[model samples]
Target: MDTSRARRGSDFARLSRRVAEAGLLERRPGYYAIRIGLVGALFAGSWAVFAAVGDSWWQLPVAVLLAVAFAQVTLLAHDLAHGQICRSRRTARTAGLLVGNLAVGLSYGWWMDKHTRHHANPNHEEHDPDVAPDILLWSRGQAETARGLPRLIGRHQAWLFFPLLTLEGVNLKVSSFRALRRPSLKNRAAEALLLVGHVVAYLGALFAVLPPAKALAVLVVHQACYGVYLGCTFAPNHKGMPVLTAQDELDFLRRQVLTSRNVSGGRLLDVALGGLNHQIEHHLFPGMPSVNLRRAKPIVRDYCRSLGVDYVECGLLASWGQALRHLHDVGQPLRAARRA
Candidate 1:
C-alpha cells in the first residue's frame, strides 16, 4: 500500500512539473489587468445606462446587460480567490471582497472556503458539498434516501434544472448572507458590512434613477438572468461526471481528471464560460490563469491519453445533455416507486 501510494503521488508530481515547465502555471498579470478594467467598466457603464434610460422600457435590455456583467465580475472573483491573477493572499482576498461582496453581493470569504473544499474533493459524495444531496439529488443513493423537497421534486429535476437556475441569482445572495452568521467565516463583520452596503447602494441607485415599478423589474430581470448565467457556466463542468465516494482511491491527477468534463469551443466560448470551458485543465491547475487554461488543455489532454486515463471533452450543448441525463437517471428509483 505504501509503494502504491508513493507511485500515485509521483504521477501528480510528474504532471505538475510538465505544467510548470510549459509556463502555463505562470500568472498573467497583464491579461487580468485588461479583464478587470473591461469588466469594471462594463459594470459601471451598465448602471450609468440604467440611470440614463430612467422610466423607459429600454431598462429591460440594460438589466440583461447588467446580468452578464455580474456573472463576469463573479468569474473574476473566482480567479482571484484561486490566486490565478495575483499571488498575494491579502491582495486577492481584499479584491475578492470588493468585487464579490460589494459588487456581486456574494460573500468572498464564504465562497472561498466552500470552493476550496470543492476543489480538494470534487464530486466526492461525502466530502464535496457540490455533490451532496440538497435541493436536487446527484446520486441514486441520495434520491432513494431523500425526504421532503429533494424527494418530491427530484423525479423531474432534469426538466426543472434550468428553471431552478433562474432563482440561483437570489439564492447566491441569500446563501451568502446566511453563511455570514457562521463563526467559521473569517472577517465576518467586514463581509457582512460590504454585503449590506451593496444592497443599500444597489437599491438606492435603482430607485433613484427610475420609478418603483421599473426599479423592481430591473432587479428581477438582472438577478434571474445572472442566476441562469452562472448555472449554465457551472453545470457542464461536473454535473454528469463520475461521482466519487470514500471507498474510491485514486491519485490526484486521475481524481481530478475523472471527475471533470470539458466543454469544447473557441474564443467565444472561452469568453462566455469565463475560461471554464476548459474545466479539466482548470481543476487540475487551479492557480493557472484563466487565459492559460486553453493553452494548457491540449497539453493536459495529451498527457492523460498517454497515461490511458479517460479524457472527456464534448460540445457545450452535449455536455448539458449528459448532465441532465445523469439527473434524470438518478431519480429513476422515485419514478419507479411512484408507478408501483
Candidate 2:
C-alpha cells in the first residue's frame, strides 16, 4: 500500500484542499430539508401524543417519548451547527441555535464553539475540553490512579453523565457563559430565551396540573428519556478513538475515518442518528452533506486502503462492544488540553 497518500498533520492546508477536491466537504440542500422536516414532525408528533395523554395513565410514557424526540432533534441541531443541515452558513447557525437551545436544552453558542474546537483539535489534551472532564490523565501514570466517579464509570458508559449534567446545571451554565463570552450576542440572547422558556414550560406544567408529585414525575420521566437518547447518539464517536495530535491532522482525519465505526441495522438508526452511523465518512468529509455518507463510505474505504490505513465497520451491538473494550483497555482519563 502507498502509505504516503495519507497526509500528516504538518500538511493541513494541503490536506484540507484535497478533502475539498475529493468532494467530501460540500452540503446537499435537499437532504437537509428532509432532515429538518422529519425531525420537526417527530417533535410535533411526540408533543401531540403528550398533550393527548392529558394527565391520564399514559402521561408518563408520553412525556418520556417527547423527551426522546427532543433528544433526536439535537442530532439535527448538530448537523445544522456543522452547516450540513442548510446551504447558507447563517441559516445553519440560526437553526442550530434554535434547535440546540430550545429542543435539547443546550447552549447553541457553547455547543458550536465547543464542537468546532473538537473538530479542529480532536483529542488534543490541551484543546478538547470534551475529551475528559474529571478522569485521571493516563499519560501521567497508570490508569488505576484516576480518581472520582467519572473514572469509575469508564469511558464507554461515561456518556451516561450527560443526563446527570442537566441536573448538575453544568451543561446550561458552562455553555451559556461560554457563549456569552464569545462574539455571538444574538446566540447568547437566543439561548437565554430558550433557557427561560424551558424553565417556564416545566414550571407551568407543574403548576397547571393538580399535584406537585405528578409534576415531579413528569420532569423525571422526561429528563431520563432525553438522557438515554442523548448519550447513545453522541458518545460513540470519539470516546473509543485515539486523540488527534497537532502533528496528526492528516493522520487524524484518516484515523478518524478508520476508527469511527458505522452502525447500520435499520431506518431508525439512519434517520434518528442523522447518518452518524457512517461517522467515519462524516468526520473525514464533514462538509459533504451527510445524506451521501452511506454512498461515500466505499470510496472513502478504498482511498483509505490505498493509504494503508484500517477501516472498521460493524453493527450497533458489535460497535458498542468495541467501545466498551476500548474504554476498558484505556482506563486512564482523557487529557484536557490542546496540543501545541
Candidate 3:
C-alpha cells in the first residue's frame, strides 16, 4: 500500500547547491512599494468605516465586518516586519511598529524580537523558546504516554486556541512591558512613556469623540475581530511540524516546509493569509514577495522532490484537520532532557 508513486528525487540536494551558488532568496522593493500604497488604502478604508459606524443605521454590522478586516491588516504589519511584504528592513520595521502599536495595540519591538525567535526555531522544544511550557513529544518508546493538565490542553487546543489568540493584544502588552523592565533604567523609562502614551492617546480619542459606553464597545469589538483573524491565519502553519532539538538552520528549514502545508484554491484564503498559504515556498524564501509564491510552487515542489523531502501541500479542510491532529499530538510527554 505504500510503494507506488514515482520515487522521490534528490531535489533537496539540488536546491541546496543552487542556494549555495545563488544565495538565500531576497525580497524585491517593487512588492513593498506597491503594498505601501495598498496598506494606505486599507488604513483609510478602515477609518472610514469607523467614522461611518458612528452615524449610520448599519453601524453595528459595519463595525463588526470592518473590525475583521482591520485585524487582517494587523497580520500585514507582521509580514512587513519580517520583510515578507516589504523589501527594505527599515521600511518593514517602521511600518510594522507604527501599524502594530496604533492599529493592533501590540508592542512592535517586543513582537519583532519574539517573532524573530519563532521564525529562527519554529517548533523547537529548547532553542525556539516559543513553545508553551507544556508541549509534548512522541519520540522513542514514550509515544503513547500522557502527561498532566498541560497535556490535556495541548490535546484539546481547539477550545483554548481561540482564547489564546484573542488575548494576543494583552499578552503582547504584558510580555513586552516585562521585557522592557529587564533592560537599563533609560530603556525602562522609554517603555513606560510609550505604554502611557498609547493608553492616553486611545482613551483620549474615545472620550473626546464618543460616549464612554460606545467607546468601550468599539474597543471590545476591535480586539475580538483581531483575535479571530490572527488564529485562523496562523495555526495552519507549523502547528503540526516536527518539534526541534538544537537550532540547526537546514533542519529548521526542513521542518518549516515539511510541517507547514499550504491551503489551496481560495482567493480569500490567500488574501487573508497575506499569501502565506504558499507556506513551502515562503519558508524557502522568507523575504520574497508573497505574490510570487504561487508562481514559485512548482519550483519548490521540484526542489523538494530532488531532495527526497516530503512537500506537504493540501487543501483548507485537510490542513485544518492536520492542525487539530498536531494539537492532539502535542499532548504527549517530552523525550529530551529538560534544559537547566
**Candidate 2, after superposition: displacement of residue 77 in Å?**
0.9
Poorly placed runs, candidate 1 (over 4 Å): 1-5
Model 2 reaches what TM-score against the true structure? 0.79
TM-score of each: 0.98, 0.79, 0.76
Best by TM-score: 1
Taking the tens digit of each residue's C-alpha lDDT, what string does model 3 give over 1-340? 3242222223345564555354345555676567666766776786676675563344455556655666666767667766776556776666665676655556677777777777766666665555645333322222345456544554455456666676665556667667666553233454455666766876675556567777777666656666666667766766666665554434444766765677786667777688888877777666656776777777778777766777887777677787667665454333222221
Rank the models by TM-score, top first. Answer: 1, 2, 3
Candidate ordering by lDDT (highest first): 1, 2, 3
Best candidate, lDDT: 1
Q: Give one digit per residue, the lDDT tens place, for model 1 in 1-340.
A: 6997787678878888988999998888899889999999999998888878878879999999999999999999999999998878998999999999999899999889889999999999999988878898999989889999999889999999999999999988999999988998999999999999999999998888888998899889999999999999998999999999888988889999999999999999999899999999999999999999998888898889988899999998999999999999999999999999
Q: How much lDDT does candidate 3 score?
A: 0.62
Q: Whole-model Cα lDDT per candidate?
A: 0.92, 0.64, 0.62
Looking at model 3, which ten-residue stretch has the lowest summed lDDT?
Answer: 331-340
Q: Model 2: residues >4 Å from true position, as ranges? A: 1-26, 135-186, 244-252, 332-340
